[model samples]
Target: MEHSITVKQQEVQKRLADLTLQQSRLSMIPGFSGQINAGYSDGRTNDIVTNQYINQSIFNASGQLSMGGDIFNWFSKQNTIAANRLDAESNSFLLQKARNDLAFNVATAFLQILLKTEQVKVNEVQVHQTLSNLDNTKKLVIAGSVPESNQADLEAQLAQDSTNLVTAKNDVILSILQMKAYLNLGFDIAFVPEIPENVSSLPITPLGEMDPEMVYSAALTTYPLVKSDELRIKSADKTFRATRGQLYPALTIGGGLSTGYANNFYDRNMKLVPFGQQIDNTFNKNIGLGLRIPIFNGYQQRTAVSKAKVNVYNMQLNRDLDNQKLRQDIYTAHANAVAALQKYNASATGVMAAQKAYDFATKRFNLGLMNTIDYITTQTRLFKAQIDKVSAQYDYIFKMKLLEFYRDQRISL
Candidate 1:
């Protein structure tokens, strides 16, 4: 999950949320600024102590420290902080949703590998069966019981079965590669996924017990996507309130400490004052409160308020859209699950009947009552039925897993 790109993207969102919350919290606190300067002046006009204009070269140093904070702004700062908090909360849910999605994707890839592996096994069996039949037909031809044409046909069938087996093995390899990609693993790495002996034995809720509406209702409460959207709407509302507060009057408070030093400063005796004394004498402190009534600023504040309001509406609409999509997905999954179950049942029955026909054809062929064409046809039918049954079984299992995931917010297998 950590290696997945989607999961990493969600992690970045979480980091952004932390930064936003930090910014919002900092906004509620006073901001401090300070500066220090030292300069040499070629000419000076005034003497601090003498209170007279003079022309002389001098060196001066000065420093100031000031802080400002919003005393009032219709609780704009509070609202902004609240909005950011909500956004952070929303990101948490989004992160979980990403993880959930990654988990589901990985599970799907794993199941694909399993299905392909099963297919390879089935194809191997078909190849072995064809080879055995070809060997028996060669013996029969030698005994003058069957024609050479039967042996040629069996060889051709063996070639086709071998090709299919190779293809199925290639498919398994491709599926394993896909699984590795999902895990962000190197293709060259030696890996073999552990396969369950009986996938159909995995626990799953019966389709009859899982109503689509009930699943949708459960997902609405448990799904991270829905929770994230709901939180985003709240966050957007807070943002709107904060933005609207900009249209109101604001109050602020500030204070500063300043001091300066000059090389040329004199007392009443017309003697130059020491740098330390000059600095002490020049030291000053000031404090003030400020009020800014928003009169006009090219409609910037109003524009901001309008945009924030629109964002709130957009968030609400997004929530609705997400809910609607979630409902549609649940219903679609339910339908697919029903269809997969039916297909699996039918395929199981078909495999049984095909197996019986193949066995009868095999006995008849050995007794010289069936021709090569008829026996080959029966074998091919059985092969197809087995392959279809395997496909249907895996498909049905995956569908059921998906439904259970939607209903419970977790996949277990």
Candidate 2:
């Protein structure tokens, strides 16, 4: 799960969500700015105290600190922050869902490897049985109890069994490669999958206990995908409100402190004012409130409001769709589990029947009462039945595991 690309992407998404939430929070506070300026003026300018135009070369310095913020904008900032908070929460759920999905994929690959390994073992057993039969057939041919043709047929059957064994081994190798890909391991690495002694003994929730409706009900609250979608809908609603708030009037508060000094400044007595005294006299402080009523700006605000409204509707629809899909998936998994159980039961009965027939055929062939063709056919049937049983058992196990994963958001074995 940690090696999965999707999990890595989710990690990056979670970080971005956190950053977006932080940015929205920062927007709630007022903004401040400060500036300092100094220059030598050589042209005519107005005197600060006399308020009269005068021709003079003056050295001037000024500085200002100011702050401004929207005191009220129909709760736009608050709603935006709420929206971002919801988004961050939604992303967290999505990240968890990604992890769960990756884990399930790994489990599936591991199960595939196990299944292929079982097939290889079955094929190996078939090959050994065929070789043993060939040896017995050779003795019968040498004694003239069976014709030379019987030995030739057994040899051909042995060759086919060997070929089948080779193919099954190749399949196991391919399955192991697939598992390695899931683990993000290098193909060149010699890897051996640890097979459980008894996969059938792995823990699973009983099929009878997994009612489709009950599972769906539980999933609605427990599934991360559903939770994420629900949160996204709320986030969209908050965003709509924030966007709509932009179309209304806003109230803002601002304040500033500024002071300036000019070397050319003089008092009413016609004496040059000292620089320090000039700075003190020129100091000013002011505060004010402003109202801004949005008229029209190429319909940008209205367009944004319309888009936001549409987004809310889309989010709601998406949530509904996701819920529907979840229900369908749960029901489908339950159905598949039922089918797999039935198949496993049928395959088990077939293997038992085939085993009995093969045992009888073996006795008849040893007594020289059954032909080589008939004996080989019975053995092949038994082999196929055993393979089918193994396949069905694994299929049933995987299906049950899938349903259990849906219920618990985790998989074991």
Candidate 3:
């Protein structure tokens, strides 16, 4: 017994499945940046600073040497990171919506399957009752209390009951199969859901705690859709600023040290110094500064600024629309949940009465006080009541979940 698997081990397959799904939504930015540059100038390698003793020209106005992010590049990079995270956020929202829908649908259908199974049991009992009645009727016919013709009628009735039981059994089997399919589970291992004992015992209509304004506010300020749009707006603003940066002048300042030798430890410019003299030193130093502003570049930066502004406006409109939709959804769900819960509570009494009627009719028919058709009529009524009661159960459950979805309470399976 001690060698058996742990609870965590038993749940390993489930954990992997959940991880795989979450991983699909998860996204990460590199958190990485780098820049590299190398170049050479034709003359005076040592003069790397200016009159003010400031550093100059590690960079140049020389040949075209393109490199990585200056300040504009850095801002653009930050914007890109934000954009990627927002995209992941929006995707996560959609996945959450799907999860809610799946949970609601499974609960509804599973309840239906349970109700249908109960119905099959009721019908099966009726069929057996009819079979017993038919056998007795045959014996009575032989004893002359009923005529020979009654025996034939009894047998025909028995045959009909058998047919109906077979059909009902088929329905139960089909329902179970559907429940298995919805759960994404294999039917190799039999699964049976525990049905609720009484519909009246379920939660009643909940009072509306949120108004339309609250729903809209939450959607605009807290919902993933609005957050994604806000991220895009921030990115667009950064892009606009970065593009405008091209209009301003770029400033650079640098410095360097160099030493030269010409067949000896002496600079060519310092060649006049006597050999073997301490004056024959070979060293140089330099400093500089540079500035360049773009006069024009075929209006590319202007176009980019325009596009960024347009995107900002478009996103604003989209976010507003999303807020409106969120409000409408909450209203609908709240109303439905309230109505369904009340209706479900009211339907419980009908189900009880129907059950009593079916039981009474069955007893009366067996005691020779009621006909087979009367018992069957009661059976149909009971079936309808059961179906209605189950339907209301699911309707209430679905609406409750919908309410929970709006409240940001959807987490547990």
TM-score of each: 0.94, 0.87, 0.55
Backbone clashes (count) for model 3: 15
Give stretches of model 2 more than 4 Å off.
36-63, 257-286
| Candidate 3 segments whose C-alpha is farther than 4 A from its true place | 1-226, 243-300, 356-371, 411-413
Compared with the true structure, model 2 gives a TM-score of 0.87
Cα lDDT tens digits, model 2, 272-362, are 8998898789899999999999998999999999999999999989999999988899899999999999999999999999999999999
Better of 1 and 2 by TM-score: 1
Clashes per candidate (backbone, < 3 Å): 0, 0, 15
Instruction: Looking at model 1, report the run of 10 residues with the lowest lDDT sum.
Output: 42-51
RMSD of each: 2.2, 3.7, 11.4
lDDT by residue for model 1 (125-194), tens: 9999999999999999999998999999999999999999999999989998988888888999999999
Query: Which pairs, if any, clash in model 2?
Result: none
Report, for every candidate in turn, its global Cα lDDT versus the true structure: 0.91, 0.90, 0.58
Scored by lDDT, the top model is 1
Better of 2 and 3 by TM-score: 2
lDDT of 2: 0.90
